[model samples]
Target chain A: MTEQRILHGADMLTERGRAEWDAAGVQVSALVDNPYKKDFPLLATKPSLAFLDSAATAQRPAVVLDAQRNFYESMNANALRGLYKLSVEATEAINASRAHVARFLGLTDADARDIIFCRNASEALNIVASSYGGSVLAAGDEVCITIMEHHSNLIPWQQVCERAGAKLVYMYVGEDGVLTEEEMRAKIGPKTKVVSAAHVSNVLGVENDIKLLASIAHEFGAVMVVDGAQSVPHLQVNVRDLDVDFFAFSAHKAFGPLGIGVLWGRHELLEAMPPFLTGGEMIDSVTEQAAVWAPTPEKFEAGTQDAAGIFALDAALTYMEGVGYEAIQMRESALVHTCMHRLADLDFVRIIGPADPALHHGVISFNVCGIHPHDVSSILDMDNVAIRAGHHCAQPLLAHLGIESCCRASLAFYNDSADIDKLISGLQHVWSMFHGD
Target chain B: MGEGIYNAALMEHNAHPDYKYEMENPTHTHEGVNPSCGDDIILSLRVVDGIVEEAAFTGSGCAVSQASADIMADLITEEPVEEVKRLCELFLAMIRGEACEEELEDLGEAAELKSIALMPARVKCAELGWRTALTIIEEEL
Candidate 1:
């Protein structure tokens, strides 16, 4: 058992901590922590901590921070309403942000107006479920999704199907942690109206073939929507190349600010759907009895906008591009490879996803045998190693796997071999604590 | 080892607990779930003639929840129902670190759990059984 400390000292990276980390192989000179860690202020200041919960939310870089402050300091106004110069500047800033987000999603056929800003990815999904799904779905019609979907994507379609008297169908995966083509063909048939699934499972850490799914759905004349909350942060997603009708992701998960999200739909689709929320600025013309809605993006973005967050999201996309997708992909894959191998070496640990280490993209979920995930996470916390415990918001997948919950250690480009080493020592500490050393 | 939440006593109760079993013909039974962590418990109590004749739980949860439930069953069984309810309240307070020295002494084996207060995230884990027991009693009234 670890000796109980009477006091939690501040400034964790002391002389002794440096010595201890060195002894634990955390300070290997040839293999150091990422050069990008300094870009994120929290990682730079804390130094010794290993933050492994990037799937929930990522650390924002200094450029994103500066963009948020610059928005507030320079042009702080309700966008698209006033005739003043500051209001126009705010509107232009948001417009610029919309263009940037559209390009980030590779909106080749669509322009800035097709990009809608909601509170988060959940809200964006709800908009599609309420507006397009509510209009298209009818009795006996079916909506198809995978068994491995986050609650955000699942619940919206569920409620819409229930309200429209439509059937909700789920496609299942085999032991390999991916959906097969035959399964997709069998589930999405002529009765399917809409198809929605996560581009990558939050728990399984397997990237679903969105392009294949889109082509299959199109064969049956079903429109496709994608939950890119996990994919956008790790992989390069081109919505046009995939040909999905609508895609959604949260800004916070993409190393941007909170309280803002992106929902990019094809231009014609966005133009055809009715407004999701109606209020002050979304009106093109208004009367006491009736009203007219503004265009596609404005019709969805009702009420006051988070102009600062939008501006910050633009900067986040820029920062990610500056790092380049190829570099981010390479670094994260190497980190996950190292992380999974080290965790698999532990006798008590059981990796939940595919056996092949290359299959895991940027996330990995595992269980500590005979130990509760919460207990495992609690012990790891003592070592300043953070991990996510619980269902990872995918209860259906966990239930299918016959486990209550598991601990997830997701990675980003900023993590390195040092974090993996810390996690290895942390799990060993946990197992030794439960079963005497 | 004695100061932390995972003390020898708690670990013993978690590994080989006397209170983790099914109770047939239980007088009061209720299921409780901690939605945050997905920890759940099916608390069964056999209260007869104003005394808790037996108390048992059939469920799965973390070590803190399981051990805490077992220790609570050990303290409250064969005791008056009113005293059981009182001890449940005190156990909750002790887990929150709200009990003084005198009140802590009254809790017996459960008092060793006062160190759980240091972990704000696991506080709910320690209180799961006590909260389930309290709910059963309150529903009876």
Candidate 2:
């Protein structure tokens, strides 16, 4: 018995080669199939099931799952409480995980001490906005965010402004979906208390120049806060190099467990700011009248921590590091380029954001002519290809573009060129069916 | 077939739609849209002598909705405008899995869409065409 061998060449894109390529691309068995993966029971019954909705919630690898199981099976004790062996072991493991995450993000041990665990990115952002609004921001102060921000990033600032009598300002995204340095500078004025922006636009896949934005915020004495929910998972991010005052992202988005988020702030800022949630673990000494609070990160983490989730997050980060961020970024960028080129050939398809791979990451949002995004998505589902539709929580940005919704195919490290081909073929079918051509 | 339930004929027709094109000029036109799935259906009808003589549907949607629309336009024409309304009511009941045996016969092939009740998300797609028919009939009335 002989095994079959697949070959690749430079002429793979040629017309004669395309048929073979397309066949290779669309054939379900040739690609990775997860029939036994019962983790997603909802997808079990789906006719043609391929999970491409990683941007919404990435599927957890087995290692991350094991890490969570191991945590509960062996080290099941509350952290930082008793002087017993089990308590000390749990506390050490939690702190070590924090240190590992800090190092992964280029933070020093002292800087890692400033990292606070929260429920998710939304809660983390609110912690900063609410705490800053109460302690630092005053009446007439301004909070600047970008037009491409997710509602998670924008709404908190809006509420903060309304409560503190501050104004929320937005920087506009140009036709290309990239915010220019001039536009960023113009938005951050003297009264700006905070300049919070997404490192990468989830909808457009446009990568913002964080270094320049941080510098502009620093020039105006405004604290630079970055929502790295989209960026941290796909790119190599260094908090120290960016010189950001605060940064936050969710574990689930990075292929970890859900309900766990990481908030990394400057040591000095975390030390100065008052705790957002005060409870058992966060207290230093409690009396009948008042209580002194624990320092920095512990003060912010008030109640029983998501110990299992945090451990799983550490495993996810370790898995990502093992894969190497540079390789992941390169792989995803190539996938995005292939997707853009394939989609560009279609007459009715319009690729949102910068079409160039250099200007963006793996996220690609587009619309087919005379076809609604939901229809496009549903048609793809029938073909066993999956994608995300609707405003993608960027309603304001979508409204600015005069579109109700657009189809988005976000790629991750696991995605390959075959996935792009599936999307393109699926889209073609959708277009032909809609136009009856 | 009773007036309230969908028949096997109607369900078959919905699965393989006929008369899914526009006439040279339509007496009435209406657009039916489903915001959830963003399914849109534009129905054009030509009524003569109190009868729907010709009908066509032009829109972008899923297979179920588009096929359902095609079937609806074909079945309703050459019938009394009043009976078309009764058929639309019966089709709605069929999709809800509430149409009795007599009602099912009135709905014809549209009754085949009872399988859609199992997939709750697809119920809207199955009903888009019937809803469009009702809209056009309502305007004429």
Candidate 3:
């Protein structure tokens, strides 16, 4: 058997093209199977490997990897711990990363002081839900969110509402998988104490009207918290302009290292809100009887930080800035648009979310009639076409659609038209195998 | 994939299901679902003269699950009532790849699915039909 190479920029549906892609995808998988890279090695060794599961985790580039390595190799000290050169360097790196993230979100240095680092966006949301729910939420108040939230965004609020006497209210998304501004306004009223929503739904990919929602929440004196996990990675976000009281996102989703998250709160609000986690780094001074906490970001940080991961995140943001967020967004949007057109034309295939590309970002979920999502996913995998299957951690949305699961192919700036072609070809093969076409 | 893992004839039966719709007057019917992967199966059975006269199934899931149910139906229909119960036991053992020589003979092509043991995620899919059959038999008894 001759070893085959999948040619880049080739139409994947052609016989030679598909074989090449399959070979390439397998090659990439083999490369990723090894764990001793010590650097940002391709998750899969093969450049031709088709990985369509960006919704789960985006692949990190070499720049992000080098940043983390450089940090550990040089200034590997606890931030704010000592006056030594290494410690000062580590502290400066931490502050610089914070500033980079703040500028990326269009927040000032003072606003950056309110951005606390956590484990992931899920933990960031939990910090607000647990801390704010404990201090601010009273009996009879309602927390408003939409139907299309991941369990991470939903469960914490549910727990908070259960602990306090507060109620959890959800604004319903229409059949098109979009929540109307009117629907949001109706759901948020004087009783609504907090309004939290995903800026772009992880499953549907429909970008919500956050600025309008923020205004409505403000009208009712409720704090608006936006889950930027899906949005921050794909689009250029200006939290200051949107006026969201708190914003949360994961660095890994934006091609950064894992185990690092950002929780951006208003400076005054963070000062007033109690810290959820109490530990060494977050304290101002500790006495036998009483302890005062540090201000804003430090107060919320609580423990020794993920210094290396934070530095890597700053590198990730720098890469995005060099590429230009607008350009990345446009490229991904084009890829998604092409995917929607190709998949929607297939018989028995139904795209799951809003049909308008202008209304959404780069995520697409769909189901092939008479074919289980698992079957579709496995067949695609056999051809090295990676995609996500299941409810995507949004069970309520899946239940609403009367479907248990759907296959999702999410894209990033690194992906191009060739990826979409591979996905279409894989789906065609699955359709033929099932229907004997 | 091992031939001993799942009955090839059974998988074929699943792919080309014979009695896949509702039985006109089923003696009993049971719905089983795998919550983890969201596979659902509804098994309908008609027993006559202490034997399963007919078995039909309707559901949505992966090919392994849907096909497994079809194979299970083909194996037990029109067999002795006690024999059907014994066959169910053998099928469960086969899924676990624990069927002895004698037990393998009873399971027939269903034994070919032994490779399913290696793919733990597909175990529930392969057993969905068999589980429903057991539920129906237990309900009748």
Cα distance off (Å), candidate 3, residue A266: 0.7
Task: Assess each prediction's global lDDT (C-alpha) against the native.
Answer: 0.87, 0.77, 0.81
Q: Across residues B66-97, which tens digit of lDDT does each residue of candidate 1 receive? A: 99999998998998988988999888877766
Residues A234-300, candidate 2: write the lDDT tens digits: 8889988998999999999998999999999988888888889888899889999999989878999
After superposition, the stretches of candidate 2 with alpha carbons farther than 4 Å from their true spots are A1-50, B1-141
How large is the interface RMSD of each prediction?
2.8, 12.1, 5.1
TM-score of chain A of each: 0.93, 0.89, 0.90
Candidates 1 and 2: which is better by DockQ? 1
DockQ: the better of candidates 2 and 3: 3
Chain B TM (all candidates): 0.95, 0.83, 0.87
* TM-score of each prediction: 0.93, 0.77, 0.84
**Candidate 1 ranges beyond 4 A from true positions:** A1-31, A108-110, B1-3
Give lDDT tens digits, candidate 1, residues A1-437: 35432112222233543443444344433235478999999999987788999999999999999999998899998888889999999999999999988888876324888999999999999999999999999999999999999999999999999999999999998766889999999999999999999998899889998999999999999999999999999989888899999999999999999999889887788888998888878889999999988888898988999999999999999999999998787677656765666676678999997876567778899999989999988888888889999998898888888888999999988987677767877887888778877
Candidate 3 docking category?
acceptable
- Which model is ahead, 1 or 3, in terms of TM-score? 1
Model 3 per-residue lDDT at A147: 91
lDDT, residue B8, candidate 1:
85
